[model samples]
Target: MRLSLTPLGVLLGAIFSTAVLAQDSDTTTITDYDVISAPALSSDRIKSEVLIEVTTVGTRLIAVGAHGNIIWKEGDDWQQAEVDTSVLLTSIAFADEQNGWATGHHGVIIKSEDGGKSWKRQLDGFELMTLEEGYFENRIEKLNEQLESTDDEDVIGELEWQLEEAQFQVSNIEAAREEGPSKPFLDLYVKDSQTVLAIGAYGTFLKTEDGGESWQVISGRLENPGGYHLNTIFGRGDDLYIVGEAGLAFASYDGGENWETLDSPYRGSLFGGHLDAEGRVWVYGLRGNAFVSDDKGQNFTTVDTGTRVNLSAGTNTNKGTQLIVGHSGTILEIDDQLEVKNRTHPSGSVMTDIIEVAEGEWIMTGRSGLLHWPAKITEEEALATQQGAQ
Candidate 1:
């Protein structure tokens, strides 16, 4: 059986959960880990470690993954930078060649000034809980005052429940602070050195304008009533897209100030999304399903990828070609003609993310550790590689 790469970060996020028992405050629970800051080990052998996200910083390529490891290719060798927090990092984004941000479990967000060399933690779940505590505490107080003057029993009941919920949240945050930060930020969007957006499971949306100096929760602007896990955020032109589990998706036109939920055709989770220069939005996820929209998601048509493996990562090449990688080392390449120009079938292991290292050569990382393939991988080459192993 081929190893599925979709678990790269998605698997880590799914396993981590904060189960808050509301009915019984004494029995409330949350996932906690004693995350410690450690120097990301630098070694040539580190390539075999699980890596989830990869991005290009000017002329350099950087990859981050499990154990808060950040590996970058400076010259011809891979080097890991010193970073705090040995948690599972889900994604990374570069605002420019000089600055970047990486996110992972425990609500960990780290930033680097010199490309991907070294990082410092800018925000964590403990701080977020502290902020939430203040917000909820204020709300609860206001609700109590409203309940005091209310004459109608109906209104009083509503306020009472609201107050209870707020109090519950405050206590939950308190418990979380004691247990350590466990909420994992799954994806990130770095607009610049000062402004950024970090999203994660359970409608966890945060924004910072002063370069993570202070973050504000903006999940209220989204219509995720069920609190679906926000999987990925992407943009092209003037539009920004957010997508995640349960076929949940939304689009923002005037920046993230306002968002409109787009109707998703698939009921399963969408792992990632990409936008082409031609205004086409491509979202791919569970079981190899991908849909493309030309009119900003008003209507969508399936891309008809001929595989059942979940697509883990999708990006546009320097030549505007689209490449998608997924479980079983499958690679789906779409050219300017909007066709599946080339495809590599399921190899032995899952390929989580793919990067074009040099023109025709590509390097991918995932559960299998690392793999090398052609930019336009084909069925013949995939089969030959599989046959050679036998």
Candidate 2:
């Protein structure tokens, strides 16, 4: 029986959680191996590890995955980077050839300066909790002052409600401090060296304008009241797009200063998104579901991908082609004419992310680790390489 990747999020989460919890011993508990302070263990087998996200900085290929593993390739061999944390890194983005950022489990945001060679943790869940606590505390104080000064019933009612919400959030943060940082940052958008957006599960939205020296909680900027998991954030120009669990989508025309929720067609979680040069918005997720919006995400039409495998990640090739990769090694291509072609790898590996190496060539990473796509060789070519000893 073939495993379906329609709901890849739940499947991967279970695998990671089980691995972390199984580290119990006589003298040490699972907490002893806290991902927050633990550095990624050095291993020769990192090339075959379950990598989740891949991207390119110039000619260098970098990928991050389970156990906080981050690897980069420039020539023949892939070299593991010096990472500071062992949390599961889910998304990575580079603003230039020399600067990049990655986000992962435990609300981690790590930055790499000299290409992708080494990374330093800039933010994490513990720090995020503190930031939230302070923000809400300040909000509650301001709201209380407004309530005491206002005489109008309508204004007083609004102030009271805002104060209540802020206080509630503070209480939640205080409680979460005991459990440690559990939320994972699912995706990231690097605007520049100084400004970046890291979003994740449960409407975890954050921004750092001073290059991660200080981060601000910006989840309230979005209209996500239920705090649904934010799965992906990507855009082109000033038009930004965010898609997540329950088919939730948001668009920001003027950068991320403000957001408006878009009406998504599919009700399942959207795992990835792409914004084209022509301003077309493509969002895809569970069950091979994908939609394109030409009018800034106001309305969308389905793109018939001809497959039911979940689409995990996508990219716009340097040659102007659109590609989406997913479970079972499926690859869907959208040409300039909007024609969709779907192809699957013979190995049937679960591909989590893909990036264009050149015009026709590509590199992808996932459960089977990192490898160049179209990896299979013809039978004749294979037979010729297999010399018999007799």
Candidate 3:
């Protein structure tokens, strides 16, 4: 499970750092949320909700979310980075100290080479509008072929009716396709400094070499065969893994050239996965299910997380491996032995990302912008204090 980096890996790491150092200040601000239109949903209006994801570049801690919001921690205070475009950002990743990337809906991929001070859109799927048009044309052709093959009068009548419905749907699809792939990027991973992989809804998976300069669609069905939405992508060395709805998991060994589905232990949506230095892989998802794979995901053993709230992201820290900021801002800490040592609530805000800033001090962000220097109390410690008070 623990694979040593080759000399190439070290070289790539250095190059990534160099890219970061070369980043320029291109930060923009979110002056007004009204500028960005809310998503249109049939059942309800798409209210802009704050979604948070955290990562470190050098010593800097960065969290990004809806409306192109980027917050970075400097010593004690957190400052918002000025980002252009009011698109909803879902995830961010750093290639090195200064170079990073943030992705969101509407084919938005913003890159920052000098830390996160500035950002520029690298690639937009607006060009893919043609693909959507072609999709509808193909559907119409298939329906016409079916109608011609039917012979019975009643069957012909039914087929004609279905054909009319198909044409109507296709027309709608054509209109939307003309708008482009508004799917956005849900999760992203930097496989060293040169390679990056991004995944999102509608089985969208994109990969880029030479940093974020160019991108191409990799392996994924237009509509996932399993009908599950992909939530996140994780990479170690040349191996890549993705998890999403319905306990679905997939792996790519040859740098994402080919992918094969893997058996998952549960049947719920997985939010994310992390690989520790010890080579152990941990994945958490819906309804408080946490599974540990000691053998690089060949097998798994379920761990008791003690809560049903969905977990978004987790990482290993000095305090121990922590599952931070999930449903309702729930924070769960697992010690070196993989035991749940403590759980605490720092805020009523739903936590999207958590990072240990210094020793016991941590920083967590969610829908309510950035919170600085949150307190971390172990579960046993909190319990003893409560008992004494009684």
Candidate 4:
């Protein structure tokens, strides 16, 4: 049997593995040059590059990908945006039309105040690793104190186990310090202009109350003791849901202050999730596995996608349809009744994300970069004319 790594695993391995290393100008010195500080290089071939995620800002479509490239389509053509970092961006979210943020490798979070034209680095892994180290250290100290003060045997046992976990996390933080900033944030949900939740590899969870100005490590809010990767975070109204590696699932009823674990039906990694307009929870991942929960993730039924290819991302259409894109250019359209209609593009590329441009039109990003279904866009001429009037 042939072994294959999931898309999430492949992305993480490419980021942290020692097989690929960066060298300085002389090609000899292993420079500690921070990707967060490095500016993204201008490239004319950005349209043909590997883009991971995309979103719509009003009438504009913005997409992000490798080497911190961010491109947006406003009137006629897709143009590159000014970005501060050179890190590989994995996910993008917008609080509204004007304020947006993008997350990627090295725990990077870039903010865009004017739609998606330009971005400034708001957070990075160096600061994240330091914050995580302090968090674990404090946790260890608190657990030790509790163990010393507790009288009940059951309480003592719980404190002791908590202390061990805190100590282990501290050790992992120390090791990470030596290897530079290796942590990567996979996905994020923009609740509003003031609140955002970001999650990633090794159960990394962070939140920012002041937009992207400052962030706090809040991984303790979840029940992921193994520190599994949190691949996707999404919210509908006050309910927030997170799905990750090994079928781990969590939900928060009152914002993110508290959480409860949900029983996941699939054991394989869940790459992404969707909380539909009808309040249904949909989680999809490896081998075309997908499940939907009608009662707030308490139970789930399988959603037959008809293909065995790994599903990476999904989006909600204006026509009350859900479209999921995955490897081998597979596109599965699930209606309101959970009926699936599958289609494939001729490119056969691994599509990471998709967005509906019009009623029956879509724009997708993947291994082969940006793609248009049916045709490039039948409304391009009319859209250009409208922009001219404005």
Candidate 5:
């Protein structure tokens, strides 16, 4: 399969805008060598800020978003924690309650040992290029020796071509090394404290067995010959699924070591996916198109959401319903039988991730910042309003 290996943001920028689209969305990360570990600014309005992802760490909720902001739930409040990078962090995953990792623009990866309280950088684009340089240079040396012994002109030419390509790859790594780490990891799934899977644009698939200490690029394991951009990945039990651009999708039954390209239902870009409790695989994306398949993606049926806005985020909440959030403040709830229910929110920004905090309440973060959707008013709040009216 071909490997495009482009920062996901740049592709979106080309479709949206070359200038402010990436900057505003924090979507693409390029070879930027500046590694700043600045502290996040404290704010009373943090809930209204643009957060990208939220995950549960034990009983606490932790979120990461633009400007290296990491927030963890503190009792009934949310508190911002210290982070080492100002790069836009798009996804966060914890292998355990105390060990987790965050991925973002510039091929940045940070580790946290104390839940989400603090983070330390383990790998960046600079070091990644260094590793690739050594790998390609060694391969070129071996190919040169093989070329010296070959007699056939066709064989000689093939070896020479491979030698030249390997050398070219080494030079490319050196050039990108000088530029910095601009590649962005779009999503992550942590299997354990020692295992992780990260995916991104142009078939960027990586696996780490010993946490982030070492990484092995494994894009060849999937059948994505076009190097389709992989957007989101989720798993339930042993079933794993990855949804991406250009109607691309893949499923794996054994963690993520191997994959099977599943039949797609939508021809447009799919932004996110989730595996619900009922063993149903749900995928959503461009326009208002969404699909659910019970037979492990062999076939999927379209869901009528009554909106055309692109769906960006989705999760099966504690309330046993699948909630999907999208552009123009779009929200759709799916029951066990795939019945649709609509909800309203105040924010119109493109929401990236969402989770339920209460029985009927939800907290979502995205383009405009943060939004708290309350399903029902509390009795105390109603009583206070009634007293004030009198």
Candidate 6:
């Protein structure tokens, strides 16, 4: 008798392994009570714990998570936005106050030209994989050139064979890329009003020049044969910075054409990064790890974040650099001088994304739903409100 494993079984196995690895990497023990409960939304087919990124378009805020959960916030409440697929949604970005896009597992890409009020499926992952193959072939050509200039005949022959093999491998990759979107995008960044950059698992990086009309894969060192997972991408003018698992940080000067790795102070997953008005770089990651880089990403210094909970996302606000949302809805606010001012716990849920809308008003999204200021309230304000209510 022969036993064969189905694709579903293989996928479950992979997810299980990933969860195990995540637990193994950290010393903290995660219990059933620690897991955030999923809200009773319209759909229950997808996993509720899969939300990774969120962004806003005008008064509307779009949040994506596991199983294609596209939620939009209207006023103080959140409602599920209809989407075609149930693939895990990871990241979303807005080019303006109107046009926006969301990506997720299985090469899933959705676009909303109407400020994320509604989203329509645009492109899938298969096409992106094809573009990546094309981009990789271009790199192989350059590698072949370097091999040809070498005096070592053995090395030249070896590299030539490798190039030929790469061509064949890329052909297979092209087929896979064409297979369509599978996994949700991990993070998305708007380079400008037109260009957008997205990165994900397996070092996947894609770019769109003509808004979301067309897209091209911008390969990175992490997407190479032996690449690492990239968690987030931060854009500043013509420069782009990426941080990921194992404290991986890379900078691209000429857009995403070339990337050089920066020495990270810690060896943990980096979740978020931002450039202040003064051009200072602030990055936060797992275990409450935070770093400040004054000179682009050339050097960094670890700062006291006061908590060891994983920091998911951060942004520059008028009050200072506010890093709200992380493990267990922990909100940490850092001043311009890199001082931790306020640290409050809003909810038991894990906060996946945070964005500053106005001077004091901030919007944060997590596992359950939308987190808005003066509505759901922050930990600090909630306490004050409770005291006044009494």
Which candidate number would show the highest lDDT if scored against the true structure? 4
Residues 264-299, model 6: lDDT tens digits: 877877878888777888888778889988888899
**What lDDT, from 0 to 1, does candidate 2 have?**
0.78
Against the reference, the lDDT scores of all candidates come to 0.73, 0.78, 0.62, 0.80, 0.74, 0.64
Q: Which residue window of length 10 is worst by lDDT in model 3? A: 17-26
Write the number of the candidate with greater TM-score, choosing between 1 and 4. Answer: 4
Tens digits of per-residue lDDT for model 5 on 1-390?
332344445466542111122367343235434543444556776555567888888899998877778889968878888888877777899988899999876677889999999988876666656655666677778888898887999999878876766665566556655555556678888898998888876566888899889987776588775657788888866788998878898999998878998889987889888887777888998888999998988899889888887788788877689999987667899887778997656444467778887787787777545566862334465346435534
Ranking by TM-score: 4, 2, 5, 1, 6, 3
Instruction: Note each model's CA RMSD in angstroms.
Output: 7.3, 6.6, 12.8, 7.2, 6.3, 8.2
Provide backbone clash counts, one per model: 1, 0, 12, 0, 8, 16
lDDT by residue (tens digit), candidate 1, 261-332: 898978888888888768789998888898889899878888878888778777777777888888766788
What lDDT score goes with residue 295 in model 2? 95
Alpha carbon deviation, residue 73, candidate 1 (Å) = 1.1
TM-score of each: 0.81, 0.85, 0.71, 0.88, 0.82, 0.74
Supply the TM-score for candidate 6.
0.74
- Model 5 clash tally? 8
List ranges where model 2 is wrong by over 4 Å: 1-33, 145-165, 376-390
User: Candidate 2 at 310: error in angstroms?
Assistant: 1.8
